[model samples]
Target: MSTTSQLAKRFREVLLDGLWIANTNFKDQLSNVNMEQATAKIGSLNSIAMLTFHIDYYIAGLSNVFEGGKLEIRDQYSFDLPPLESEEQWENLKSKLWKDAEKFAALLEQMPDSKMNEGFVDEKYGTYLRNIDGMIEHCYYHLGQITLIKKLLKQKESV
Candidate 1:
């Protein structure tokens, strides 16, 4: 593979690793909990459900940009993905996020060199590279939140 291709592949791998951590640590648990339960605070943050949404949402958003599209966000968006209307809704998005992530990763992996450096630009960030960088960082950032959420969930379960 070419250097650019290699870079994109590695980037996909990083995001995939994030996907595994997110899905295993949180999304899989959504089936067992209600919306309120999923959004329930362990302490400081909202809950695993919301964090999961934020993670998946941004991955999809950035992936779309890499795929030659863009989505509008308010003030750089936030890390917290809110709860759905009900447990059922949350369960649905839970599944959709996984599928969306897989598709996102695949599209990003195909990104060509010419396009990787190109994307909707903002004065603050400038270039798709920086935004993509932010997207990657965002994943790991929430993985930290997910780790804490998982620990809390385990504690709750054991008690």
Candidate 2:
């Protein structure tokens, strides 16, 4: 497979399905989470919902760039998750994440392998391959956090 295709596959593995790396994808982990559990606090760490919004924020922003939009996402606003007071709101957030993830993967798959060496957005941002790889790594990092938070939440429930 081409590099772009491989990258897309890896992206899907983390956000959608496939279990080669963490043994659990975002879909799997979030499927079991309700609004209460998602928003529950585990010490001072970010809630699962906050982490989900943060990851989706970057994915959607980059996907916009892939679709010829301007790079407008900022780190400061990435965690600005709106109040998820209801189950519907929580579901909507997850729905957006899944939709954005699929779109991001599709766009990545369609990208020319030659463009992988081209700088992403600007020369200072480094190459498309680097950004794509960085996103995958970032997802894994937060995925680990979400998994641990879920465990802690479950433990709290049991007690």
Q: Would you list the C-alpha lDDT of every candidate in the order shown?
A: 0.62, 0.96
Report clash pairs, candidate 2. Answer: none
| lDDT tens per residue, model 2, 52-142 | 9999999999999999999999999999998898999999999999999999999999999999999899999999999999999999999
Error of 1 at 15 (Å): 5.3
Q: Give Cα distance to truth, residue 6, candidate 2, Å.
A: 0.2
Best by lDDT: 2
lDDT of 1 by residue, 48-120 (tens): 7777777777767766665666565453465546546776778786777667766765675566657556645
CA RMSD of all predictions: 4.0, 0.6
Backbone clashes, candidate 2: 0
Clashing pairs in 1: none
